[model samples]
Target: MLGRFRRKQGANTQTGVQEQDIGVSNSVEQQGEKPALHVHMPGFNHNGHKVTRGIKPDGESGRGGIHPWHFIRICFRSTSHISMIVNVLWPFVPAAIVIHFARPDLHLWNFILNYIAMVPTANLVGFAGQELARKLPKVFGILLETFLGGIVEIVLFMVLLHNDVNNNLVPVIRAAILGSILANLLLCLGFCFFAGGLLREEQEFDEVISEVGHGLLLMAGFGLLIPTAFYASLRGSIDDALLESKTLNISRITSVILLVAFFIYVYFQMRTHHGLYDSVLEKDEERDRDRHEDLKKAKLTLTECVFALALALTCVSLHAVFLVEEIDYIVTKRGVPDAFMGLILVPLVEKAAEHLTAVDEAWDNQMNFALAHILGATIQTALFNSSLVVIVGWGLDKAMDLNFEVFNIVILIMSIIVVGNFLRDQKSNYLEGSLCILIYVLIAIASWYYPNPAAGTSNTAEGAGTKAGG
Candidate 1:
């Protein structure tokens, strides 16, 4: 009954603030003249392909594509739309420098300051990267951004791997890897669904996007499971040292294959199946309909964006090092569980803020981009970031592998399964989204009590990792 009523009411249609833009003409439309941007932006040719044919804006189709105006347009997007805290977080960036230099002994303060500092710096890196991407071809720009999106996670992993020379930090790195995935799949995605559902009774997204993302995630999860299973099968049959050696060898081999797969998937997303991403095409059109859009233009130039990214990356790298340096102190001295620190606090600081864009997209009924953002970030973490850390561990002689603790492995695979089920219908509501958050809360509590692997334990992670690397 409700479905019928909704169908009659067109409830699935784009709603709110859009009706005013329909069936109306502005001064330019009154004269049957094109908007000023239509004159300069590239246009699509017949058959919906971007090309520049004569002065037709596009080859012959007379449709518009990205242009300089896009850069200007995105520049004006309010930070509030992306993150409420990014604006006020700048002070923490400089404070990180002060706290590190003046009172390095303050492990708690050092950790806290650098941790908070990650937010604004991540914003700058992402904002500038998007700004730069806009200057290139649309498909290539999307490709570049998609491939290079998670600079924070990459830097953090590098810092953690480089510091694990003593081989004690691999478990934290492993937990951090799964934690990042959990944050993306559950915490970030849940908020996107919930926040969007608050305004919309139900939200539907591009199913193709969700399907491809989840497929990749499942594949990556399977790859990780292979290592865990191998470790489990042999742990009881062989010497602990020999089992670690065999597991480490398989992990390195698997890491290489996963990296290859990651690139292949990127090619699939940005090239072969690019049209599947048409969900973004309607995005600007939706925003342009807003009454105040005429006043909007980007504030940064191409050079300015480049400069900002370089500076932002420098700060992000510094903060990551500072934050990682204190993990031992926090876990051992503060009596904080390593699992809790890695699984909850670290990911919350690094990813929880950066992902607000997904939530914003959900609010605006652009579920395709929102879902893509959520899943894409997770795919990168699970496949690319985790694999990179493992390979880098090889180079640095650290024993980083996919053989996470049995409990961490179970939670991660289960989280992916649960989230996949929620997304199977290609639709979401606030209630289902709230359930995701609840599950994450339960996991957080479990992580808090999850004991670190003690010395000479059977776990291949620290005591496990040390033996594994040997």
Candidate 2:
């Protein structure tokens, strides 16, 4: 009976062991078939390891994932930024080399280098102004941009007037001022109309704004004409000294009047008649909605904007210094008349970036903004910037008179008439644009051939001075 009991106990123990083994195998099989637990939190357990919720086992996110560094890398590789970087850097190389190694005798090289340098500097100023404008109200923003846009030309003229050893550059300066007016009225406006009209059949803007701007331009033209008329009347009778004194008096008075007029014009545009200037239609509004969002995205912080302006102004001022110092040498060496330089090259240098902006606005079919830009620039050049030059010249004892040449006066009057006709209806087409451009081209060509007998003698003296300094 004892033997039989022992055998039964052993059999019971074996059955129990078999049951335990089966349970272990089932548990292993169940674990192998089970899916992973995907927790949405950053830190989650997967099988015994902690993994980020969105990241895969290899530390990469699933499809459609974008890393911050990769995004930044892509932006830096974009075409526009790359081109801007190139523009900002390449010009400096020639400028630096010229500054270090060029001699006054190498006037051509100096002029080329200085001009190249000014291109980027001018662009920087435009960029800075645009950035600042983005932060202001529309009216104030436009005014600020106009002011900033004209600053370079003002500074250049001042430097030229201040450094005029023989009182010869006065004509050139006058021509430059006149050229700026013509450029805005004819070249810039014409191009804008052309670009906009090409894209669309016709473009329309606010007639009231156009009329007001045209009226202001007419007043400025008349104001300029006073000095010229006075000069013509007394040309044969007055002595040089007496004529100069009278001219100074007239310039100072005219400048004050222009300044007052400028303020009144600003008040009218910004405060009283603000609504007249905005010509946004429903379709335009819809288009600009997206643009507004883009602008918001691109907007700079206040501190950044200020810093950019400061930096750009510093660079532009430096370039202006280089340019002003070498202009006489350039004029002397190239045998090019100063009037031509002022009418063509100087204005081109000062207005290139601004011109690009006007063109772009027109191309985008923002005719109102484009027209405003052109007209505002024209008015600012005529009333504010040119007037400031006169006042500043008087303060500095520089003989800057508004006694423009007959050619300049005639051109100004003709421009007023042509532009008046065009803006009368506040409508523009490609044909009108073509006509304006044709006029500008003819004017430019005539200016290239225009003779200034006085320029030769002035250039000789300037060359002598340069040689002495060297």
Candidate 3:
């Protein structure tokens, strides 16, 4: 709302003009060999105002009109918060419209894979921004990076969606998930330390922000666990039989009761630790304040940011739909379920795009935010996105359960193992990243074969339930 108008005061107008005038004055003073005395310039009346001639655009006494730098400075100086909002939100309009149209065509697999691709594009934009930052003044460089990075992400998502995707998307999903995690944990964090070492030892991390990240990670893990346990149960005939009998009965009400209980437990736990939570909130506020100050110093308004964000989201939605269709096509040819395709193939393909942002962010001194992005994305996909799939499925004609079958259990276990390792260390090297990639590859390979006799079960019903929980 504040970004809707231009500034009328023109308080910052003199700055750009002053810079030009000073530079010109210095250059002229240095041109002649003699020490020099000041001289006056000729004046003329123009447009109801007196015009000084021979001053050039440098804002000198006898200079010409406004210089290019001065003009740019004025634009920056004059724009108000209202104009900023327009700048930022305007780009998002196209993005939102695209997403709105494309949502029907997208499958879960496609969305995840496309998200992976977006990461890389974002990183690349970040890197380009870093380069620009080095070349330009800090304010312009950072703004350029933010603006371009946002645009790049949206563009990539749109491109990915423009195609039809189907089949074997599981690999892509899995690969992308790993890519996001590895880039954030290993690439972003590692590079931050490496590059940060080049500067001063006084550098500190945003602990409050880091705590939020930790919370996100924990939530993602728990969300995945639901699907994991459900899938594991399906492989166990005894457990599957019991659950099936109980779950199939509308009058039984056991599932609902359990869910309610679980909700209560979670609520109470949160209530108990609310103070600790408030500490995290306080820290977040501090970080936000600091960020705000930095942004203002850099002469960037939030509206430009909003515009870029909206555009990116739109492209991402479109690309996500395309990716889903392509995966479905590929999977049908390969004769695999859409879920498996999402779990495997889609992620692998999407990795190239996802890392772009991470790479770019690493180039900047913005590792903390980059880390947040990776972890936050993962959490959103695992929890919020997955949850929405289930809720929406319920609203649809069919009761779509997202139960994991036996194969999904393996994936879950593997995910748990890797995530645990990742969190335990909190510091990742290139080797760790490679290991994650290797783990994903192994899982992909293993998913292609038939299950053992002990593991064999009807894949659909249980798979649906587990997938939903996941």
Candidate 4:
């Protein structure tokens, strides 16, 4: 009996020990699980030792489950995205103001608002062009981007120049044409170089391509120079009507020549010497291979791209109508010279999208792509768009000429020279970029104070001439 009792006591002790081990295991598993719940539920304290009110043993946090601090952090992280949204939507504010006020006399307000509206629409064009280009060969893609990107400026000029038969805006259009070239060559290029240089000590691009682009730019400048020189020589000698007729003839001839040249350029870039522009293609292909899934996700169907392009162009065209209607009034009311409007404001509004793209490419150390974008835009504006404007003007019976003022001609020549020298080396740094930007700023300041000789005189003369001719 004594032995039996001893065994039984031992068994009882072993059973108690087993139960205690199981309890410890259960406690450890619970502890491990609590931290995961705390992570997803912000109401739970970090240590998992405390939970906020109304958060039961289940994993649900208190109402809404998002901490106030967490929401703030998210907003801070997405600040850039928010800025883009604001850029696209802010124009609506001015549009709303215009609707509320409904005052035609508020020309400056109207111009400012309409110009702001152009910016986001221009961005839409850029985005659509990018989408379309993705589905094309690299050389063709660049071409599409260049030509399509420039459509905004061309369309704006067409609408503005065509609206008034007397062509009072001839001087402004000339100034704007030269200004667009300068903005791309100096302002846009300068910013790109600056950004690229800041990101890296040095950046390199294709010298041959740069040289070719410079050659084309020089050609475009010469094309404009001939007409301006002809106008200057004839201005004092001939009567106003005869001089205008001679200028129109010269503009038409020059436009034809420029159109031909632009075609040749396109052929050269796209067919005869496509290899020059295809360096980026090989790298892009390799990248696409590595991130095939990513490329797939980003790709848009052809139909989608076309739809986007059409939609963007429609919006831009509508905005151009409003802008052209108010532009002259704005110039009159604000005492801002038409030359100044063309040189600074118009280009800024029209090319804002391309300007951003060049800077972005530069920041990524893709100097080739950056330089291509700048030069491509410069070429398109100078050769194709300028030529098209003249042709369109003639077709519309407005007879726009390429006769820029002496001040504008001088500025254009100087800008081309400065940029040519900078690009000759085929390499860039931050200092060079800073110098370009400084030069542009100085030019902008000079233009601001520069009086418009035609602004006061031409309006009266054009009115009288129209009456006499009629």
Candidate 5:
């Protein structure tokens, strides 16, 4: 519904002007544009009268128009209520500090405080990323935004790797990777559609976004499948020792391949095929203009953006360390299922800010932006963050691989298919969103009962490494 006709009042009219306006309107129509109507988008309605005034054929002023949000400011602030709440959670950071040293036995409390504290820092990182993104050209900005958005997830993964003294966290890390993807695909996107549907009966976005996201996800899923299948097939033919070695080698190769595919995707997205995304970007611009935040310029300066990002990265890294350290205690001592802890709890905390942003974008009728954010982040979790963990594991010699449990991979592939089908028409409603969430709930329930395998016997590289080392 974006760019629909909505006539504005106060335009000059005079004798003989009608004929001139008619000619201009016809010319505008021939140019494939509506004759200078006030911008109208889906989910909102306004009574408009036909106007005789001349509107630029470009349909806008220079680079659209700049609203107050585009004004250069010295400070950075997020107007989102979620961001405010995340900001309020900042006190938990210091609380985590005190509890870690003062009362070290309270592992559960330490975990809660640290993860809660992480919310604020991750929000800050996203804000800084967004602010900095607005400073660059549209293409690079989108790429940068996606990269920085996943920084928290990446950092947490590395922290888990660094702290996995017994290989216990490796399974959880693998689960978290799949969990993050599910979170974005089902949870975040579900809320986006549900929220957007609350405003508009049905909303539509560019199919290209869906195609790209789904294609890449399928590719990543295939990468996951190959390694799992290899492990399964060879686990029978070969002895346990040889099978383990082959699995790790295959997983490492898959990681490199996925990374290569991701890089090629970046080029395809930002270079030769950049034109494919202009529709999304244009719609995003129209959405901002509708909200009177026509930010063709940035709200923060280079110095403020850099400083904010630095502080955010440090805080997120620090709190992530705190959170990872307590996982063992909760899983082993507290009897919380590691599968549930990884697949359900971890993603909720890690992607809190992103979920909020998606919902916000949907509420504002920016379905394109919302969908792009969701799909882009999910793709990042698959190709970038997940691969980094394997390669990082390779360097550390700590036995990490793409050998996710067969059950988990099946769930992942099915979820991807479900999401891809929903996106087939490039239209969304609350009902579709609800279904996605329902499936996620089912997955969570299943995970709640999922067994926490013994440290060395879990379905990961640890078993193989242990066998060989022994």
Candidate 6:
């Protein structure tokens, strides 16, 4: 009896180990490994049960678990792959439909011609930075873009300022400033912050970007202060002849002086914040140390570069010329006020498409590059574009002394304040986005209802323009 019990115990121990490996039920082991109680997991069976090979248990997934990050990356890649189609179709289809149905006197052909000429030049100026960035290191790329963009804007404005169209310098300058400011604040910054939030768990901008933002905020503050000073001077009866055409030459001289001083200040401040040689030095060092000598041969083909440049130029030129006309017409003829157009419609129209670029960059984890592009673009729009418009307006027959209607004044002030707050914090949230959108709306409303220049109203921008031109 003892020998028999020993043998049975050994057999039972072997069966239990085999059952565990095959995932057999406990009931089967208890029933002495009966065939009827056996369940197979492909090529393995308990007791005398027949198990077929290549058969998995019900509800067992063949695919392994995927990482959350991997899934998200895949989704982003997929979305980007199809983005171009949507971009081209979304704007054109709707516009074509509208034109077909509305049948307005605005001939698409003339609009196209004006758009092609004006907008492309602006784009070319913008693309100068991109070209610089691609050829040089990132930091210098930004500075190059900013400075060159300013030069391009100035040149173009000079050309247009002397043009024989409506020949109203003031409106052209005002429109340019309006377009530039709106583009920077609403589209560029807004999209950057939004995309950053969505793509990154917690996005953090680099020190360089932070410094740039700070500089922008300071400039905005100075811009506001300039207007305040003008108002005070005018109210106090400083110079009755100061604003007259007789003093136009003197005004231009003053404008040049003030502008030069402001530029010098900005230059010193930038150099202090960001060491001048860092970006260039780093690029040189990297090139020197590179192990793969063959990689130096690799560059984007000239043809490809030219095509991209052309496309960008075409789009921008349209934006600069025809888009402005459309916007002006819509506001003047169709009851959309300047402020509303500047604050809302302009931003939405100009930026909505551009936001796609940021989103794509963010989704790919190129946070620094994307953010830099966005911020740089904004700065260019503000400092470069707006300044050029005024200078150019001066050249066009007479000084387009832009008077920021009270609504524009409020909008500009609120924009500076909100953007400054946003940058100072630099930790964007949904709440901040809501606040920004709300501010945009409020300014738009105020601009629409606000009266134009009243008797004895001050011309803030013109005063500054005069000071700068002088």
Residue-level lDDT of model 4, residues 1-470, one tens digit each, is 99999999999999999898778777878888532232454444323434444332221222243355643332222112322553555456458346525976776666667777777667767765765565466788878887788989998888867776575676667778988998998888898889888867887777756898899998999998987788776666768777767777988899999989989999998998898678754553343222333232322334544655786688778777777777666666566776787888778788877887677667766677777888999888888888888888888777677877778887898888889999888889888888888988887888888766642143222332121122
What lDDT score is found at residue 330 in candidate 1? 82
Quantify how close model 5 is to the true structure by its C-alpha RMSD in Å: 9.4
Per-residue C-alpha lDDT of model 1 across residues 1-470, encoded as one tens digit per residue: 99898886775454533554443436568889865542455455334545444322211222244345554344335334555446467889899889899999899999899988987777777666554554555445545554455878888889988888567778778888999999989888888889888987998776777888899999999988888889877776887788888899999999998889888988887778777575453453264223233223333554556666778789989999999898888877787787887799878877743476667667767677667767878888888899999988898777788887788888988988998898899899999889999999999999998877665454654354322233
Writing each residue's lDDT as its tens digit, candidate 2 over 23-141 gives 87678778885434444543532233344343333221222333445433322221124225535554573564466355756656666776777666666566656655744656677
State the lDDT of candidate 6 residue by residue for 13-83, as single tens digits.
Answer: 99989978566556666778854545545532222223323322211112234444533232223224434
Residue 81's lDDT in candidate 3:
33
Can you write out model 5's per-residue Cα lDDT over 197-233, one digit (the tens) per residue?
8878998888778888899999999988888888766
TM-score of each: 0.80, 0.76, 0.46, 0.75, 0.81, 0.58
For model 5, give the 10-residue run with minimal summed lDDT.
44-53
* Segments in model 2 whose C-alpha atoms lie over 4 Å from true places: 1-90, 93-105, 278-293, 455-470
Lowest lDDT 10-mer window, candidate 3?
55-64
RMSD each, Å: 12.6, 17.9, 17.0, 16.3, 9.4, 19.2
Which scores higher on TM-score, 4 or 5?
Answer: 5
For residues 1-470, write the lDDT of model 3, one tens digit per residue: 34433343343466768788778778877996444567654343222223334321112212223355533342233222322222232334344335545673444434444445444333333433333333342323333444443344233223332331221222233323333343334443444444433433323444543555556555554544454365445555566656644333321232233344334533432455445544543343354423443333322112333333354445544554544555544544445543344444444333332344443333344544444445544443444334433343334423323343445544554564555555454443444445555665665566555331121244333323222122
Off by more than 4 A, model 4: 1-105, 238-240, 280-299, 455-470
lDDT at 303, model 2:
49
What is the clash count for each candidate, in the order shown? 9, 0, 86, 0, 0, 21
lDDT of 6 at 344: 49
Write down the lDDT of every candidate, Cα atoms only: 0.74, 0.69, 0.40, 0.71, 0.76, 0.46
